[model samples]
Target: MGLPARRPHAPAEGRARGQGGRVMAPFPKIHDLYVSRMVVMTVLLTWTVLVGLDVVNAMISEFGDVGKGNYGLLDAVTYIVYTIPRRAYTMFPTVAVIGALMALGQLAASSELTALRALGLSRRRLSLSVAAPLLVLTALMMVNGETLGPWGQRSADGMKTAAKSKDMAVAQFSGLWAREGDIFLNAQNGQEHADGKDTWLELDDVRLFEFADDGRLESIARVATAEHRKSGWLLRGVKRTYFEGNSVTQTEVMEEHWTSQLDAAALAASASNLWRPRYMSARDLRDGINYRKRNGLDASEFEEHYWGRWFYPLNVLALCLAAIPFAFGTLRSGGAGKRLFIGIVFALGFWLLQMQFVKLAGVYRFDYRIAYLMPPVVMLGVSAWLFRRRSG
Candidate 1:
């Protein structure tokens, strides 16, 4: 039979009538920018506030001696800020993923997301939209690390050293004087140089004396250039001669590798005794390990922190990612302050676990590559899936 007639939407009631029932009000369209911006702000602001507070407290408590030197509150502030960009860059992607998941989840609970779904927007499209901004940030983070992380670390270390020199401890380079018969070597200073790849000796001069077995002075040789080498010092432009019984037996030479009992690490320790675990870069750590390893040096202690460098950024990212699932609903229903307490706990736990894992890996002579890869694999996989499903 011909249709009796379609019921018209109620013109007077301002509602659409459909076969199913009544058409609900159209849902608001989800905006990509709005979601990403909100997430970025929340994560960045939270991280900065929390980290900044911790930094201030740490400086006050532990930096008293360093800050009292040429370094002051201003220097401490500079170093802290310089270090933040690296920390923040690593923190961004993680928070972006988690925050987006969280922001979307909360919206879902409030029905705001449901309304968007009703408007013909699929969960997949919504996820793609939110994750787009994260891709851009990923690029930024890569560049930031390549540029800022290395430089900032270096600046912080220099100021810290000048702020507090390791001049107290006496060592081979600090006041090492060696005299083998007529050959005398006095190193005024020995410190790390050339981006900590090599050790340098500040030599005021050197004095060499030639003597007869009868205890008579035969000749004198003046000092020359003293530079660093892999084996040891490269002393150049040496002038030596012998004068006896109106006859001159003399020799002039330059360029020699001075492999002393003191190794490069030992030299660095003697002069620039101010290095800390946080000072060296990834490359520095690698080279340091190689130098010590080649010389049969027992430096498993520094080796622990050294191996940690290769995975540092990864670890940072992993911690941030692991934090995502926790923020999802762990405290989504709670007050902001309550959520933060849980966040801090998450951060501390992540740090401790990472530290212990790295240390254990080093102590037991575990494979560093596996250890480095594990955290990223676990955290990033879970976080990625968790965020995708949550957003979906």
Candidate 2:
């Protein structure tokens, strides 16, 4: 028999020659590595540009407040510096999706993506490769949100408050101030304290101004410390002075019970770093929710934030994945403007959808967890469909 007919060379779709001309498996790993590096670098560049712009705008706004009280240029700069982490954390999700889009768009423009596709890399596999870097970024952002973001925000607020208020009780931003009926209460400062398994708020140098119904000054009480307990609020080192026309009487007490409609948990939330629920960590949010619930307060807002924090990573990943399909389609022949527009549209749409769901949740009294999940779930479904269609 003649020598066996020479076998035809295999197509290059799933095989490549190694150093010795031996066949190697498809280069999915190499593609993944290459894509990951490009995505990460693009994300950092995007994050820097966006955050820098945001910080500049904030600095301009802060400068306008420099002349107020003791808030000078230096103080304003310090405040802005401290708030940078919070700003970065807040802008990350939007930046990440946009950056991924730009990176893939660049790849498509360069024809590298086309080569990868021709080499039998499915769109789904490519998307997964893109997702790996984004997932890593998402984890880092989550950590920043919980740690640096909250810490920086709290520190910035404290610095601003202190700089603006000398008396610490007269300024609006000084400390905790509240009104319950005819009693106006002010705390020079307040701090959250943890005792084993329990946590509570302690108000230092608490002052209570009891006004008459007709707006006359009736009495004033000063307490060295106000502590919130399970039973009620306890005012220690109390000194009460009564104003009865020309007659005045003073009384001193070791402690007194403060009976009012104010919830300690609510006060604690306000006292702890001027609490903006959006900036708080999930742990703090949970504590707030539990505290408010135990005191029979409406925990809807806290619950909303708590659930949102828990779902942040999922939302980010979904948005990033959803953004990739655009690169494979319109971005292949499009320029940076188109990529940016697509990114903005997706980011804004997702943001608006989330806001609408939150409003609906409030109006309909539904679980906020469901509301937070809806946007990401919808995006994920859309992404899956697009990948399938594109691959087909």
Candidate 3:
């Protein structure tokens, strides 16, 4: 079906014309916005399906102690909305790039662009008309990434925990590690033992130490199983091995538990939320980046994540730029299908390379700039060059 008409402009670009040899024609701006919006919406719908599949897949993987069915349909709707924006943001640029080109190329093929050009609408004006709305869109996407994306993630994660409570397995003790003032806990298993975002481990051989507070072993508690109740935790079959100045005290009991002050949801979110950078925004990515840096941990993954976020909107623009040359490059021949296939291959390859490089960056401690900047930089620069060559 044909695209719907362009909505009115946001007033800024709705001004009177004649900036250069020409200002953008109202129809061109209107047409481009209409098409770009359609492109974006199409991309978003596709994202919703794919992301929905992914969400289901993830929940399926954690098919442990399924404890949810608590949240209402509103829960699912909110989660669906939450999941889309960041993903949509990531994909929007590519959509705009490819979609804009496809739309324009279609227009050109049908002689719409040619007619407009003949009517004194230069290619420059046309590009400006198209890009101006896109810039605004990019900004809106960034905002969604910041506000809604993470909030949705937390809420959705909570629901998942409730659903997966049956499989709510706790981790067995995997020793202890500390950074800053807080120590990170790991168990043989971490799926259960808590509600919300936190992971409460049923430590097998618990080992803990705190340096900042007193440089002394504050308190060590080990138990057979730490069951997470709503307010706090209930540890069954407990033992406490305490250290005092070189003296050690041992206490054993049938049952014990600790109520932690930290937000369980946030902690659980951190542990389980690993590997899903698509849910994180640019700012969230930066926080993740900084976390790795402060821990003296290899941060290339987070660094790459940060770069991906920072360069993401630009990537969209780049993809659009890339499509321009390709659309025109293969234009002499006539098959939109081929261009699309090639674009898919290109997008996939680039994403795979990004994942591989980020891992390699972690392994080698490569410079953040080198790891993050190179791909988008190189791809975008090449795309720009190609577009110039085509237009020239």
TM-scores of the candidates are 0.54, 0.73, 0.58
Pick by lDDT: which candidate is best?
2
- Per-residue lDDT over 112-173 for candidate 1, one digit per residue giving the tens place of the 0 to 100 score: 65565565454444555555555566667656655676567556655554454432223222
Q: Write the per-residue lDDT of candidate 2 for residues 1-392, one digit (tens) a residue.
A: 78989977554534565777655654458778899899999989999999999999999999987987788999999988998988988898899889999999999999999988877676766888888888888888889989998888877876676566543322324456777888888886566778799887788778899999899999999998888877778899999999998999999999999876676765765576565678788998897788667756567778888898888888888899888887777889978888888988999999999999988998899999899999999999999888777767
Stretches > 4 Å off in candidate 1? 1-30, 66-110, 116-146, 163-277, 298-332, 380-392
List clashing residue pairs in candidate 2.
none
How does candidate 2 score on lDDT? 0.82
Model 2 stretches with alpha carbons more than 4 Å out: 1-28, 169-273
- Of 2 and 3, the candidate ahead on TM-score is 2
Question: Tens digit of lDDT per residue, candidate 3, span 77-96?
Answer: 55555566555655665555
Flag regions of model 3 displaced more than 4 Å: 1-82, 166-270, 274-278, 288-295, 329-336
List lDDT for all candidates, in order.
Answer: 0.56, 0.82, 0.55
Candidate 1 differs from the real structure by a C-alpha RMSD in angstroms, to one decimal, of 11.2
Clashing pairs in 1: none
How much is 356 displaced in model 2, in angstroms? 0.6
